[model samples]
Target: MTDRELFDTYRRDVYYLCHYMLHNAADAEDICQEVFLKAFQTDRQGVERIKPWLLRIAVNMCKSHLDRRKRGVLKELKHFLLERRRDTEAADEALERKENELETERWLRALPVKNRTVMTLRYIHELSLQEIAETLDIPPGTVKSRLNRGLRQMRRDLGKSNPNLKGAECLE
Candidate 1:
């Protein structure tokens, strides 16, 4: 596929990754745009691996943004944009789903940065072990270990915050 075509196909996934990584939709959109722009500016050889390359760029952008970030920017942006959606019955369902998603997101946000990234890349983005290893520049074995450890941490946290959820047993 051509660069634009591949980029279009993967755009939502890239945005989702950025949103998950940054924990804010607006910054995610910004990073997604930046990643695509970087891809567009790349040479043909670089464009050949655009999916993983774009993910790497998005990851780097989130990391940079996090490292020098001001507090509440992400939260304020999220709250500001939350009520601006179109009104409809289907939109109500969507809003409900968004609520659940946001709750899950809050749980994720409480985790360590590395665990959050690992969970987002492994579970949300649905990347293969090798692809995640490539994107994170880590070994496949390490990715697996991180996945296990992250899940364990998430379960423990969830059990504490959610009265209905039992730690680790929730997975069963």
Candidate 2:
């Protein structure tokens, strides 16, 4: 496909994937642009599945960006905390829901990259186990183990913070 076609077809998916991975809209946009630029500059004549190919590019770009700077999580937490203040202007119910969502995001952020990626792909993006394995270039068994470990960690963290949280026991 031409560059324009590629961008039109996959721009939203790429952007969301980057945003989900990085939790920063501006960085996601920059990486999305870079992903397409790289795709355009290279030869993709033999690419069989564009979705996975593009996603792999996005994943690598996000990993490199994270590795270059260790403070990304702190920056994102700060951004979320600041954003939470803005939510206070909304209705009480909405504010409560937003808080819960933010709390979930925080928990997800605490996870290691591999676990976070697997969970995001499996739950948020609703990919099958096999698809996640292919996307991450790992075996399905490894994906399962990482997902189990990640969930256990999240449960442990949540349990320590809030013993009454409903889903902590479900993680067992």
Best-matching candidate per TM-score: 1
Candidate 1 local lDDT, residue 8: 78
Candidate 1, residues 3-98, lDDT tens digits: the string is 679677989878877776677778888888888888777675744455666787887777788777843223211222234453544867877868
Off by over 4 Å in 2: 1-5, 20-24, 41-48, 68-93, 165-172
TM-score of 1: 0.71
User: What are the lDDT figures for the candidates, one per model?
Assistant: 0.70, 0.77
Candidate 1: which stretches are off by over 4 Å?
Answer: 24-26, 44-49, 68-100, 161-168
lDDT of 2 by residue, 1-172 (tens): 8889999998877787888767788988999999999989989988877777788888888878877867454223222233546646667877776777687778878988778788777776667788788778899999999999888888888888877766636354
Worst 10 residues of 1 by lDDT: 72-81
Clashing residue pairs, backbone N/CA/C < 3 A, model 2: none
The TM-scores, one per candidate, come to 0.71, 0.70
